[model samples]
Every structure is written in structure tokens, then in C-alpha cells.
Target: MKKILPLSATALAALIALSGCSTDTNGSSMPGMDHGSSAMSTAPPTNVGTETGADHNAADAMFAQSMLPHHSQAVEMSDIMLAKPGMDAKIVSLAKDIKAAQGPEITTMTNFLNSWGESTTMTGNHSMAGMLAGTDLDKLKASQGTEAAKMFLTQMTAHHEGALEMAKIEVSGGKNAEAVTLAKSIVSSQEAEIKAMTELLATL
Candidate 1:
């Protein structure tokens, strides 16, 4: 060797810094390294301000499951009235309105059940209130003119009353905020519809 030269301070510092930043087997820099972009890019997404599956209770689940079939029956009844000829204008309009309102409600309840990981179908053979029997539906299908309109109004009034009963239970016992809110809304709107149906029945 010609001459042994000591490394300068600047070059020594640079060497030490590079050695401190050695990467691990996974290619991520060692601890204490500035991992500005790479670290942030690999981070998992945050779920803040979102509704998760754990947000509902048993009452909420039951409300959704029960309302699905109830709303479906309302829609089916509306369809039956809509198909009948020579129906009163007011009755036809009411049937259309019932169809419009309850169809979306059915979809909303179904989604609530799905998100809560609950079955959409209600278990047990418990009969829902105000549901027309097969014979009642047959009589409705056979009637015409004012008779059909009267039957629809009478049947739908009872149906709305039954929905009000179920919704009141939800309003009192449901834990999910959205579900309770929907229950309250159903109470209000269906109450009004029931009143209107009562008035219509008087005329028919």
C-alpha cells in the first residue's frame, strides 16, 4: 500500500446512513427509515363514518323480515285492483300510489335483512294481521265496478292497520337508527293512507 488515508467526516456519515437503511427480505426499509410514500400506499382503508353489519338488533331484523312479505302482499293487492276494468278514478289512483310506495319499501327492507346477515323469510307459521285469505282474494278478483273498489279499499285499510301495528313494535323496540326511522315513517304515512281509505270506502 502507498499511503493509508483516513476517510473524511462527510463520506463517513454518508456510508453510515446507507448502512442504517438496509431493506428487509420483504423489500421494505428497516425501522427508522423514511417510508413516506410506500408505507402509506400499503395501508388498509379506514371504515370511519360507515355503517357495518353489527349496527342492527334482533328487533330490527324481525321488523325487516316481517315487513318484506307484508309490503309484497300490499303490492300484489294493488296489482289485482289495477288489472280490474271500470275501476273508479280515485281507487285506481290509490292503488297506483300504494304500489309506488310499498314497492320501494320492500326493496329497502330486503337490503336491511341482507346487510344484517339475517334471513329475509320469517320463520314459524305465525299469521300476519290483515292478510286476506285465498277466498277473500278470489272474491276480490271476481267482483267488478264499485264492488271491487269497495273490497280493495276495505282490504287495504286493514292491511295498513296491520302494518301500523308492526311498525309501532319496531318504533318501540328496534335498535338500528335507520330502521326505527323507517318504522316511524311507516306509522305516519300508513296512518294517513288508512284515513284516506276509510273516506274512500264511505263513498264506494
Candidate 2:
């Protein structure tokens, strides 16, 4: 009976030790569960697009809005130059390049305004520099040959100058990365074109 009693107590001790081991295993698993929860909680935010999409300011909006009409007028003038007969080959090529470049840019600016929830049209009576008066356009349309080439070059030079002014403003104050990059490109390309036109005017 004494031996039986000690064996019974020994079994009880063994059972208690096994129960303690089970409790320790469960306690260890709790840390892993907590780590998993922490990983989920620290996951990156899902609204990155919203943050990137709103990265524009008033200057960017104005650049897109005001440049839309300015670019359109330039395209119109290029078209008029292209339709004229016996135009200078250089002038014709320049007109074609202007139309090609500004047409896509107009679309890009329109998309920018639309995405920004801003009006595509300029609201005030702000006169854009180098905009041709109807009379000026009439004079350009009436002229022919070298006269037309000279007129187009002179007018386009002024137009490019106005664009450079606007682009410089955008480069200085615009918040959108794409808009600023575009403004820089305009400054570079238009400055070169202006120099070319000046040389062409001298030749004429």
C-alpha cells in the first residue's frame, strides 16, 4: 500500500509536469500570433494613388488652363501657314513641327485640368501675350510667298516668346512634377526655335 501510494503521487507529479509543458507551448504560440497581428497592422497604406493624384497646386492648374488656348492659337497660325501656296520650305517644316508639338500638348493640358477638377477655360479677361488680333491674322492670310513666310516667322517668334514667359512662370512656381518638367522642356525647345526663326528672318 505504501509503494502504491508513492507510485500514485509520482503519476500525479508527472501529469502536472506535462500540463505545465502544454501551458508553456501555448504561451510561446501567443507571441507568434502577436507578431502576425503586428505585421498586418504595419502594412503600407492602400491610398497611395489618392496622395499622388492630388499633388498639384493652383500654379499647375493655371499653367494647364491658360496654356490650352495659347497652344490652340499657335496651332491655328501654323495651320494657316501650312495652307499657303509657295511658302518657304523651312517655314512649312516649322509650321508642321509646331502643329505636331502643340496639338498633343493641348490634349495633355486638357487632361490635367480635367483630372484636377478645374475648369479648362480661363475665367477672367486676361489677355494672353502674343495673341494675334483678328486683323493681324487677316494680314497674315492675305500675304503670300516671302511676305507670308516673314509674317509667320515674326508672329511665331513673338508667340514662342509668350509661351516661354508662361513656361518660366510654371517652372518657377508649379507643384506638379510632370507640369514642371514640361515647362522646362518648353523653355529649352522654344528658345532654340526662337533662335532659328531669328536667323531665318535675317535671311529673309
Candidate 3:
């Protein structure tokens, strides 16, 4: 005759422990069992802060797209003047200002485009204000001494004016507060630069 004994408390506890130690089909530790480390230990923790998305409209998109190349051409014009010999100290200083200010602005506008999931390139046949024709750039590049400085001032004044026109559109129509702020800055700064260039051109 065989005698069957009911499972003891110690034996039941052992069974429970074994079941808790069992793993899933994917080899991950079963729930309620501590693996002695965080489950996310395999990868470093990420910290994406509480940042909300930007709210932009079509006008904001247009402002970024148009302004990028406008600023780039301004930088290019500044470079042309900087590369020349015998530039006036004031003119040189202005060129440096344009380069310093617009360089960061280009990056800012690019970020606006990226955040909006928009293309950085302008769509359709858009004409930018204050843009130098290829021949105008060639003319400016070929000049020397005071002539180069005068040409740069003349060209940049017009370029800045063009920027003002575009910026006005952004100020009036843009939805993003940041873009409008930048537009206001461009209007104020470039207006002052335009006046300074006009005075400098007279001296040249």
C-alpha cells in the first residue's frame, strides 16, 4: 500500500519560488520577480523634456524659406567685401556685423523649418528682394579698393531693404511669435545698417 502525504508549507513555498523564478518565452524575467536591476538597464535612460511643438502657419513657412537665402546672399556679399584689399574700417566693421548677425539668424530660421516639418527650400517661382544678380556679384567681386567698398555698401543697402520688405510680410502675417520677433529685429537693425551704409557710400 502506498501513502500520499499532502504538500507541506515548506514544499508549497518552494513550488511558489520556482514558479516565480520561471522566465517568459522571450527569456525575460517574469513579472513580480526582481532581476536585481532595472528592466531598462540595457539602454541608457533618455531625457526628452516637456517641450511642446511650435505652432506655425503658411506665412511663417514662407518667411523662413525666403529669409534663409536672403541672409546667405548677404553673408556672401560681406565675404566679397572682406576678401578685398583696402576696405574702410567702418565698412569692414559693418561687414563683420552682417556676418555675425545673419549667420545665427540663418540657423534659427532653419530650426523653425525643421520643427515645422517643412522644406527649407522655397517653393514655386519666388523672387527675393535685395538679391544680387549673378552679374551684380561678379561686378562687386571685380572691383578693388574704395570702389569695392562703395559697391558693397550700395548692394548691401538694397539687400537690407529687400530683407525689410520680406520681414514686413512676416511681421504682418506670421503666426509664430518668434518669427515675428525676428522680423521686427531685422526691420530695426537693417534700417539702421542701411542708413550707415548710405553714409559710408557717400564717403567712398
Candidate 4:
């Protein structure tokens, strides 16, 4: 289920402005707002697809670009657990939830990029916070029984923290309203899961 934030319109607009947009009073585009392809200048292209352009920006693009892979890794992690034997029921459920929630988000962000005339593919070498290292994944793959469950929890906690970092960046710097909203949702949902994982970790 999606969590609804209590942010008012004024608050949401204020956040977008703080992200460095320069919208007019009616929340339309500001003429001189920078539209560079960096995270700093994302305001929806003024005339990308519609008769009037969608209100989004580079921060939105970065959020989507970074998050798509981030979410994909999470789903992959979930799949790893699901494919293994003798997993704890609780951990299996958690993995399923993470996979279910993130799969749709990946698609939504893909659509967001397609609509903006932006390539969904990110360029250059980049590192995202919380992604499992190759060795980390290998360790999880090699483990079995309780050790496997323990490894998954430990690794996924770090993974979720990395997601929180990315989401926070999007919340503070993104320009697209929908993108910002998703960022807030990620923060809320993932934080709860982190708590659950922490508690589960203590028992193991």
C-alpha cells in the first residue's frame, strides 16, 4: 500500500522551489530557470510532448536514472532469497514485499523518462550507495540455512540505507512533483523495513 504524505500544496511547491526551480505564482515555468542536464536544473521540459510541456527537471532525471538500477538490485536481492531453500518465513515475506513494491516503481520511472524525451540509460561510470558488492553477493549466494537468512538481512539493511540516501537526494533536489512524491514514499517504506530487518537481525 502507498503511504500518503501530509504535505500541503504550499509545502510541496516550497520544496520544489528549494530544489532550485523558478516557477511563477501559478506554478508554471519561470523563463530564466536553468534546464541543464545536471541534477541542479531539472524542471520538466517546457515543450517536450504535450502542447504545454510537463513540469519536470534534471533532478527528476537523476532520481529516475539512479533509482532504476537501485531498485533493480533490490529485486534481484529478493529473488536470491526466494530461490534459496529453508528461508525464514518472515525474511521471505520481506523480500517479496520489497520486490513487489520496487517492480512497479522501476516501470513508472521508465515511463517518466520516456515522456520527458530523456534516455533511461545513465551515462558514464557511477556508483550508488548500498548496492551489494560482488563479493557480498557471492557470500550470500554461498551461504545456506540460518547463515543465509542472516546474510540477507545484513546485506539488505545496507541496501535499504543506500536507497534512503538516494531518496533523500531526490526529495531535496528533485523538480518533478511525481518524482518527489515517490522519493518521500521510498523513505517511509524503506525506513520501516530497515526497522523490521534490525529487529530480525537481533534475533538471529
- Candidate-wise lDDT, in order: 0.82, 0.85, 0.83, 0.83
After superposition, candidate 2 runs with Cα above 4 Å error: 1-53
TM-scores of the candidates are: 0.75, 0.74, 0.74, 0.74
Stretches of candidate 3 above 4 Å error? 1-54
Q: After superposition, how far is residue 142 of candidate 4 from its true place, in Å?
A: 1.3
Q: Write the per-residue lDDT of candidate 2 for residues 113-165, one digit (tens) a residue.
A: 77777899988787777788899999998999998999999999999999999
lDDT for residue 118 in candidate 4, whole number 0-100: 81
lDDT of 3 at 182: 95
Backbone clashes, each candidate: 0, 0, 0, 6
On a 0 to 100 scale, what is the lDDT of residue 48 in model 4? 38
Off by over 4 Å in 1: 1-51
Query: Poorest 10 consecutive residues of model 1 by lDDT?
Result: 41-50
Give residue 146's lDDT in candidate 3 (0 to 100). Answer: 80
Q: Please report the candidate that would top lDDT against the real structure.
A: 2
